[model samples]
Target: MGDVGPYPWLRAVLAAFAEEVRGLGPVLDVGCGPGEVTAHLAGLGVDVSGVDLSPKMVEHARRLHPRLRFAVASATDLDLEPGSLGGILGWWSLFNLPREVLPEVLASFACALVPGGHALIGTHVGAGDVPRTEAYGGVPVTWTTHLWQPGELGELIVAAGLELTAQLQLPASGQLRPQVLISARRAPEIAPGR
Candidate 1:
């Protein structure tokens, strides 16, 4: 996935998210495939790094974006420190996570984020799971693509203690399914004796 670049709408969403958390703290790109989006955020002046479950992917990302940081890690096992990240991105990356596990991951995101930090998630829009035996030029793989409706995903995000701030729904085109981009923000901290 060498700099395949993002869709126009995705670029806009990323730009906006980067602007929101530019100086708060570093951002983490969960499931960062090739670090393209990680590099994109860095170009926008947001401090960002990426992690992927596949060591091969992380290797490619590191080789491609040498200036950026990439690590081998799974979304399910991210041991993030509370109030550390300014933002977290799950851009088109969390579909493989089981439905039950996603909420826990979102909760982790909420806990890791600083007050006022944001989380941006992009996922295929639908209702069930699509099993796959191959992907990306027919590379042999075993995984399930779990599709979710906007409202269902939004409910999980809100339940994770983040406020839903924006949602963008895009229609299916070519081989791509309909997709939704949702952005949520952790509530800001309150002052003492306000």
Candidate 2:
């Protein structure tokens, strides 16, 4: 993704954050619009693969990031086998998911992650379900369902078997709203004590 104002800075910050972190292995860049982030990770010597909902985006990403693997796939029903990923990076993707389908998609992410794997997702924070019909790059775009509360998002991820670790509240700017940067990890196992 190209820098839309401060988005470039945010991207840089996210890159630095990932690099300094340890323990994560191969990563799944979900909703990899143009594979820029995937390519960035590959440049850092991280094993990275990407998946996007748009075929055009997939083709563009493949062209831009020839060293990384990318596919046109839905987040709700990824074709990956169980325990296949070490981490997942979902950039502003959860907002695009319909409320009813969120749980199913979260499960897909969880199933693909290996034990102890983590996922970082960027999403809008609202007080109630927000119905926003907006335009992206001059294209008419409409997001079906968006969560308004942090608790709702927490419940969604926890239900998918991921434990919440952190949440970053991005600043709201212009017509664009801020989002919650959520990071969560998959538990290794259910403790016998529990």
- In order, candidate lDDTs are 0.93, 0.75
lDDT of 2 by residue, 109-194 (tens): 88888887878777777765665566565676666647546677888899998988877676777876766677788887677888
RMSD of 2: 3.3
Question: Which regions in candidate 1 have their CA more than 4 angstroms from the true location?
Answer: 1-6
**Number of the top TM-score candidate:** 1
lDDT of 1 by residue, 43-116 (tens): 99999999999999999999999999999999999999999999999988999999999999999999999999
Question: CA lDDT of 26 in candidate 2?
Answer: 79
Which candidate comes out best when scored by lDDT? 1
Error of 1 at 102 (Å): 0.7
RMSD of each: 1.5, 3.3
For candidate 2, what is the TM-score?
0.82
In candidate 2, stretches whose alpha carbon ends up further than 4 angstroms from where it belongs are 1-13, 16-24, 128-134, 189-194
Name the 10 consecutive residues with the lowest summed lDDT in model 1: 1-10
TM-score of each: 0.96, 0.82
